[model samples]
Target: MRGPAAPPPQPGWALKAATAVVYAAILAWSVFSRGPEGLQAVAMLALGYAVILGLIVFAALAFFSLWRRFRTPRNRARVMLGLGVFLLAAVVPPFAEHNDDNRQRDIANAEIRKAIDTLRQQAAGGSGAPEDVPAIDPAPRASGPYGEMERVMKTVAGARLAQHRAYLQELQEIGLPRLFDARRLARDTGLIESRLILEQAERLVPGYRRQSLDVLNGMPALVRSLTIADAEKDKILAALQTSNAASNAKLTRLWDLESQILREFGQMITLLDDNRQYWYADKNELMFGRDGDLRRFRQHQESVSRMVGEQEQLGVQSLAAVPQAPLR
Candidate 1:
């Protein structure tokens, strides 16, 4: 007996509205969280959602077919509800997690940028220990692939900054004054100090260069430690490569500048010795001859002064080359 042919299935306006709101909210949050830079991520997310949405639509058509196959209205409603719940469970969690991962990556990149900025500032300014610098604000260190890389990057940054700080201090403290003491051929304490500092810097610079080279060389292996998606990994690796090249170039310039200073110091010492025969130390006066010792002395002084100016200019250029954002 057909007991009042079953009522036609009604559209569930409430469920449809709720589903629209959920999808809209996720899309909105994704754009908002990533800013302008996140358009690619947002597009990827939208594509994933669209695929899921299409599957849901197909499932709805299947559910309609099942509705006709079923005998009772009660059975149809149960089947629809169960399928809807299953689809919701499958679709929502992954997108939510994708959103979460986006937020986390942004946070980590910001921290890394901040840390690199601090390093750039320190190296450019070339003053004070790391303690004198502002402390990095604390945040949850990202776990997984980024965690190890982040730590190592910051460590390398710190080492570079420390080396520059030490170099500047020694240069100002001991290098410049005796560097220009071209008239002092005596065994003075200041000259001794400068000589010792020059030898120390010469010894330390190669070590510093070696350390930097090691860091650059090991970067490929370090990148391999990350277990992120291939696309993401390649992006990070590119930035790291740029950063390494810049660091290496700057380090080489610094080494050259130091070498120039050391070489000038040695030349200045030689000039003092060569001109010592022309000076009467007791009278603080010069003995002149037709041999052109006086002319050579004047020329040496001018050359030393010009070299000093050159060093100053090189230092300025080196500082200017420092990246405002190293990791970018």
Candidate 2:
């Protein structure tokens, strides 16, 4: 029977206090549920607090203009919408399991560590921790570089090459070691054989090279990256694949070479890091052209890149006529 008095305006601090109480209630429940794991409970509470706080700030700004008392009626609608979104957000992240990012990053790091160990096993004679992947190495041969080179040449020159992109599938299944018979050879064996194999590989593979110290240093990183790449991983595997069984073993040797190169390069970088001032001096000297502990790393990279490109071109030209599947 009486006209309604104007509704009281809600104070900003009151809304914030209510939000804080809701959060505190949620945190208490979490702590009670995880009593023995108090540290974990605390961590969860902190996370929840951050997410909720972010939501509160976001909602406050979003709704301020929408509230009629705060601003205009139109602004009030916008603010209401923002508050709804913020409330929804506050409830979502806590239920998100909190371990998704840590899980994924842990998996990536695990894969990298496994790959490194795999390299060590293969290099040390194919043995190590319970690995899902087997490490295989090339055996050293009595044949000299020239003879090895001839073998590589024959492997490439045989002319009965299969050209198919699906070959990459075969590669992933077999791995780089399967591309060549590694047990029959070692570093010396490949120097000559590598010449031919590399010549062919330079063209046949998409991401590979035998020259350039910088690239040699980066090879393991590339391999590790490939093992973890979300897409185009096949390209990396393909580089390690070969149609010839003997070649597959040899390819494994190539993996060893790459591993050794990376290890050495990392060591070199460490050496540089230890002598930071010396490194800076030498780095600048090389770039500007005066020989003081100079390292021709960049120039070497460009020159080797050009040569590798040419060699790869020659390989593709040589094998272009061969019947094989197209690259994916």
Candidate 3:
């Protein structure tokens, strides 16, 4: 007769313990290592955990199959307990790590929004530009598709800047705020959250600034001619210095506003100038129309505004010599 069935094989406690240790070591190592390529590190950890999870799943299946052979209640209970531990050890960490990554990305997105809002307020305050307008320098004609396009775009952007600058000058001349019931809102740029707004401003600013260089252009010669016999010019100048129906002060704020817009406008010009191809439309036909006479005209226009205070005083001095006109 056959001897008593061989005693059931003992559970592989050593293998399970070693597996637990290995899994713990890999998780711990992946969690701790930080490096220059942070995204790469995160990706690597994700991959590592995925591999570890796969291995644990396979191992747990093997353990259950082998342990089920035993008929004793105590042995069966022990097998179930080991399975619980293995499942818990393998699944918990990857879930926690994924949640943490998502949370961080959300926080970063929020901060970026705050930064953009601040930028917007500063731009709209109408306080003028960040710095003095630089003298316009001619750039070499761009070649190739990209270069040509950039140049053309710069030209277009520059043209737009000039038009806005002219509009502002006209506003200052007749006085937009001074004449019209103009209202202005200078909300804080810190509140601007959108990147699209910032990008739009970036694209528009340089061209706006480039065109403004001539707002004051040829204005002096005309002012000199117009003010000669007409005392109204001087009066208009004085009205500009003080508040009227338009501006509350001589500083129309448009000057500063234009100045501010120009800063960005100037930048676009530089960017377009640098990348000519983006601006270029065709080989024979260029992007924007070029004008150099504008450069000289702006010089005099600025000089006129700067001397307005002294010019006003001179007007007072000259007024004493002229006969007073009769009122109807």
Candidate 4:
């Protein structure tokens, strides 16, 4: 019966139904997994696929029309020409859009690199706190075993020792002796001034003369006591000189240690500044898709922080070890 009625016109809609099912499944999954953003991404992908499919269909139609018009050579040539133009039109826009995006990205990257270079230059040229160590204050001049030892040390044979020796010797021989002489002179001047004041009071009032004589009688003993006090003062100064010598030695050692620590601290600061500059220069790489670079940068930062913390702690301990004077 007419070749089985052309096999019931084979169901061409079956393929389209299967495609629709696949698309629905993908959309459902996208919605379930990513919410609104997923839906947006899927919509964009679908739009792009639709455009591509439409282009393909148009191309296929043009090829089919060319075949159908092949009987007339002139018409065939014209159709082929039209198909080529249409194909170029369809392809060129997407390529141009892609090229434009690449150009924009390159321009942005170039600007970022230029900024990084400027930062690097600035960091390289920058200087911070002065690195020169401060001079230690001179030790006090006094008397006793410490002074004797210091006097001996001053004569030692090296240039370094010789300088310190000269300083201590000068303190002992000239500075302390001059200070003692000045103190004696001041005491005598004060005594003389007191006597003059009392004498003037006696001259102004006859009744006060008796009181002044009583005070004047006490003056010789006061002068004798002052002489005795001067002897005691010399003894005290001798003890102070010994104490001063020991204190000076300790202070010298502290100065040396502190200077070393300060130099190391300055170096650490410079290194940290350099590290900061490096981080700024590579910030885009660290922040964006460069996972490996980010990891390395973080590790370096932590290492440096830990090292500086340890050094600071050690410095604190060292400072604490130095003896401090008791508060009165």
Candidate 5:
């Protein structure tokens, strides 16, 4: 008679329950740690489930072994240790990567904020004094079209465009109420700067009034974009005072309008850039002998004008597409 009746066989239900608890715990931890932001959360859960499933399969195979390998406590302990190692390997990297990404984003946002403050100050006319203006050399003027003066003007225009683009991008990142404030600052500064540039152009090339005028005319369109954005924001806020459904619908329209406005703003900037190039090239032709450059320049101007006209038409269409309020 065997050693005192064999102890009752261990139930498979207990083993299954234990495995399920471990799986659930791992999944919960992954989700909570990642906070459901990106693919990393999904990946972590998938990997955890895969590892657990593999361990379940391995245990099943070992239990069915002809030699009964899993029957021994020592073999089971080794199997558990291997599973732990595999689980650790599968889980650690994603968390580390997510932490690094968050840290870098914080640093970048801080730098952007600092830059926006500096730009705001400069836009408010924080430059030192009128005496700070660097003196331009008064060398004898070259008769050729591509003279030193024209070169200098091109350089300055390019620099201004770059600075404006950076400022716009920064404003866009900050979003809303602040966006309007920054834009107002930019608009005021731009108008003043445009007038000054026009005056300088008149002095440099007396007959170049038309080109400068075209450049000046584009400035208002840019400013109008800012005004439209502000008006739309106000309208959205006003709409929120009504019923929830109407408010939500208005908000959707406002979002669509803001997107369209941004697109138009970008296009307007591109058009202005083209205008600047055309103006300088045209000025050069007037000074130097006419060449193929002038023909290409005119073609570019026409293309940009057509684009601007299309943008205007789209703007009108977008306004029309907005649903009218129901009569009370």
Candidate 6:
């Protein structure tokens, strides 16, 4: 009995420190793997709630058990310290991720401002579209959360610029009425085809489902992108106006006319579609004859055409008055 065997030496301080490090690392990994966003997305789900509640209960029970086992005040304090560490580790990941997203957003905002500034400079220089619309190229390779944001901002700007240029050209050349007429005709043709298909049901084509309006499958949808808010549009317009008030005025008029034209067109189309029951389709041919609704359709078409003509003429005159308009 060598000195009554000094009670087994307590685990070395180094061992205790290592154990703490390992525990903290595991907790961190568990919390981070799901990510803050993922956790929030699932938090309301039944399974998610159960798991979260279970974790809370387990943590509480474990804390109390450890508290009792470590009876001495110093030991009790150490246990409390461990509990604090566990809570800190659990909370750090969510806060860290939230901060990172905010940082990324700030960086994206800076890049957006820089891009918009480039556009302003291009407008001032009159180096429009086909050459440099946005005048700011997206990063050659963009990845990660903020990278995606920058990419989308650049893409929307480019698309909006191209659309603006196209509208400008239409005003100068073919005119809005002609452009609108072509679209209306295309849509009407689709409606006629759909009518014929419905009249014939599955008899017109083999294996065709009566429920499927197959002929209208590729019709253009009437949706506007909402990525750019009104405020952003105002900012862009202000920037352009600063460069060339006359040119920007013309552009603005055309954009306004486009909205009005589309609205009228949609309403007319909806009216025609809703009263399709009054239209008769020739069973053997792709022909549709408007019956009782013929007068209504013609009247509406004439109204739209007249409105569009008036708007187009005004937009065109404005464009003509502006010498060296960036539109060309």
Top-lDDT structure, candidate number: 1
* Tens digits of per-residue lDDT for model 6, 221-320: 1001323345644543454345454544544554455455555555555665686555443542223355446666667668766766665554444322
For 69-152, candidate 4 gives per-residue lDDT tens digits of 443434433443444455446654575555454444344344333333332332232221112111222221222332222222
On TM-score, who's better, 1 or 3? 1
Query: lDDT per model, in order?
Result: 0.56, 0.38, 0.39, 0.37, 0.40, 0.46
- Of 4 and 5, the candidate ahead on lDDT is 5
Question: What's model 3's lDDT at 38?
Answer: 74
Give per-model CA RMSD. Answer: 8.8, 20.7, 25.8, 36.7, 23.2, 20.8
Question: What does candidate 1 score on TM?
Answer: 0.51
Question: Which candidate number maximizes TM-score?
Answer: 1
lDDT by residue for model 2 over 56-118, one digit each (tens)? Answer: 656686656464465643344345444545554775456434333333434334433433343
Off by over 4 Å in 6: 1-11, 19-81, 126-151, 160-250, 253-328
Task: Rank by lDDT, highest first.
Answer: 1, 6, 5, 3, 2, 4
Q: How does model 4 score by TM-score?
A: 0.21
The deviation in Å at residue 143 for candidate 1 is: 2.3
Q: Model 1: per-residue lDDT, tens digit, 79-194?
A: 45555555557755786677666656555666677677776565444344434655443333765545544555555555555655555565556455344443443444334655
lDDT of 5 at 25: 59
- Ranked by TM-score from best down, the candidates are 1, 6, 2, 5, 3, 4
Off by over 4 Å in 2: 1-18, 21-59, 70-102, 118-122, 125-230, 233-235, 238-328
Off by over 4 Å in 4: 1-62, 65-68, 126-328
**Candidate 2: lDDT of 36?**
36
lDDT of 3 by residue, 1-328 (tens): 9989977655467655655666565565455533225767777876876687667655655666675554444454355455545555765567556545444434433433332333223323333332311112113132222222223223323332346444445434432222111111112122122223334444554454444333223223333343123564465345333333232122233344434443443443344344433334343333433344334334544654555434334323322111122211
Q: By the lDDT metric, which is better: model 3 or model 5?
A: 5
